[model samples]
Target: MLTQHTSTCGKSTGTSTGARPGRPSCSLTQRHLQRGWFSRTPLHCPHRILSSSQAGCRLCSGKKRQYSASVRASSAAGAADLPAPRENLGDRIGAFRNAFWKFLRPHTIRGTILGSCAVTARVLLECSEYIDWGLAPRAALGVLALLCGNGYIVGINQIYDVDIDTINKPFLPVAAGELRPALAWVLVVGLAAGGLALTAANFGRTITLLYSLGLFLGTVYSVPPFRLKRFAVAAFLIIATVRGFLLNFGVFTAVRAALGAPFVWSPAIIFITCFVTVFATVIAITKDLPDMEGDLKYKIDTFATRLGTKNLARLGTALLVANYVGAVVTALRMPHAFRVPLMVGAHAVLALNIILETRRLESQQHSQLAIRQYYQAIWRLFYIEYCLLPFL
Candidate 1:
C-alpha cells in the first residue's frame, strides 16, 4: 500500500505502508519541488520504480534547449548574410548616371562628338587665314547643343519604343523599368528646348534653323501620328537627311560663319556629305537586323523584316564597301595639295576589314551577337572617317 503525504516544500511524497526490505520510499526534495520535477506524477519521482521517466524528461528538456540555441544562432547568421536594407545615396546616383548614359545612346553620342569636332577642325584647316581664337567657345557650344539634340532624339525614341525595346533590347533603362516614362519625357523635352534655345541665342540663324529642322525630323521619326520609322523608305530618308546631310552641312556652315568666311561647297565637304549619306542608309537598314523578332511581332515593317536578315546584311555590306571604295577613288583624284596617303590607306583597310567581318558574320549564321558586333564595327568605321576627314 502507498500513502501520500505533504512535504515541507509543499509537494506530495509517496510512502510504502507495507515496506519491503531494501526498498526506499519515494521522497520529494526541495530541489525537485523547486525545479517542478515532481509536478507530473508520483511515477516520475527519481526514487520511484518509474524513475526512468524523470531521466527521459531531463533528456527531452536538454534537447529542447539545444534546439532553441541552434535556432537563435541560425537566425542571427541568416540576418548577417542578408543584403543591406537600402542602397547608399552615392550608389543610387552612380546607377542613375549609368542608366542616363545608356538612355542617351552612347553610339550616337560618339558620332555627334566626332562629327562636331571634325567639322570644326576641317573648317579651321580650310580657312587657316581667318582662324580666330574666339571661335573655340562657339565650337564648344555647338558640340553641347548637338549633344542635347542627340539626347532628345534618342530619349524620345526610347520612350515611344518601350514595348519594342522590352523585346528587342531588354537592357535599355526605359525598357527595363529602371527609368520612368514620365521622367524620360521630361528629360527629352528639356533637352529639345535647351538645344533650340542655345542654338538660337548664340549661333546664326542658319544654324538655329538647321537645328530646328533636325529636331523636327527627330520628333516625327518616333512620336505618334508621325512615326516615320514605321516606313522603311521614310525611315531611311530621315536618318540619312538628318545624320549625314544636315549634320555635316550645318556644322560646316556654322564653323565657316564663326570664322567670318563665306560658306563654300568644298570638295572635301561634298565628298563627306555624299559618303555619310550612303553610310547612314546602311545604318538605318542594319540597325534593325537583330530586332527582326520584335519588329515583326509589332508589325514595324523594317528592311530586316521585309527583306530578311541575310538579304539586309548583304545589302548593308555591299553599300558600305562601295562607299569605302568610292572614298578611296575620290581621295586619289583630289588635287595634290588635298590628297593624303592617310585617307586612301585608311579607307582601303576599312573596306577590307568590313568585307572580312561581313563574311565572318555570314559564317556565324548571322547570330544576334554577331550582327550587333558587325553594326558596332561599322560605327567604328564611321568614327574613323571623321578622324581622317581633316586630312582629306
Candidate 2:
C-alpha cells in the first residue's frame, strides 16, 4: 500500500499500481495539461509539488507577468490611435495677424497714412505760425478713422472678388483660404461702423459728410448692384474721386477744423487734388493690367481690357508725364517764397523716372512680371507725391 498526500489544491497525490508515487495531481493540473499550460515532460501539478505559499507566489507572479504584457499592448494600440497635439495659441494668433496684415493691402494702407499726415501737416502750417503739438491726437484719430474706412472698402472688395482674386491674386487672404468669408464680412461691417462712429463723434459736419460720401463711393465701387468697377469710366472716376479728391479734401478740412480755422480751398489743396486725381486714374487703369486674365474671364470690363496692355501702359505713362510737366510749370509760376526749386526738381525727376520705367517695360515686352513691377513703381511714386504734399 502507498500513502496518499493531499495538496492545498485539494487533490490526492496517490497513484495506482505501476504509477509513480507522490507525483502531484489535481483537477487543476489536468486542466492545465489539456490546455498545454504546463511543460510536456510529465503529468503533474508543478504548483502542487511546491509548498502552498511558494506555489501561490509562483502562480501569482505568472499571472502578473501575463497581465502586464496585455496591458502594455493595449496601451501601445491606444497611443497609436490618439490625435496629434493642437497648435499653441501664440502660433495661431501669429498666423492670423499675418493674414490680417495682408488682407489690409499694405501698399494702399501706406498711401492712406501718408496722405492723411501730409494733409494734416499742410493744414496746420497754413493755419498757425507754429506747429500745434496739442492737435496731434486729433490728427491721429482722424487718420485712424480714415484707415478704418479704407479697410472697409478694401475688405469688401476682397469679399466680392474672391473668385477673381483666386486667378489674379491667389495670395490674398480670402482667396487663399486664410480667412473665412463670413469672418471677412464681419470685419468689413465692423470697420465701416467704427469709421462712421469715429468720424461722427470727433469731427465737424464737413468732415463727417465728406467721410460719409467717401464711404458711400467705396461701397458702390465694389459692392453689387453698383459694382462700378465693372465700368471702366465709372471705376476710374470713383477711384479718382475717393482716393484722390475726397481723401485729400476731407483730411484737409478735418485739420482746418481742428485748428479752428475756416476752411479755404488753398492753391496747395487744388494742386494736390488735381495731381492725385490723375494719378489715381492711372492707378485704376494699371491695377487691371496684371489682372487682365481674371478680369476678362469674369467680364469685368476695365481700361486695361478696353485698351490693350501696351496701349494702356502708354496712356498711363503719357498722363503721368503730362501731370509732372504741369506740376513743373505750376511750380515755376509760384512766387519764389514757395520753395519753387524743390517742387520743380522733384517733379522733373519723377517725370524722368516714369519715362525710364515705361521704356523698361516696353523693352521687357510688357510681360506680366514687368507689368507688376511697373504697377508697384507707380505706387512708389504715389507715396513720394504724398510726402511732397505738405511742402506744397
lDDT of 1 by residue, 81-100 (tens): 55668988999999889999
Root mean square deviation (Cα) for candidate 2: 12.7
Residues 256-342 of candidate 2: C-alpha lDDT, one tens digit per residue:
777778767888888898999999999988899999999999999999989999999999999999999998888888755357888
How does model 1 score by TM-score? 0.80
TM-score result, candidate 2: 0.78
Evaluated at residue 102, the lDDT of candidate 1 is: 95
Error of 1 at 296 (Å): 0.8
**Model 1, stretches more than 4 Å misplaced?**
1-84
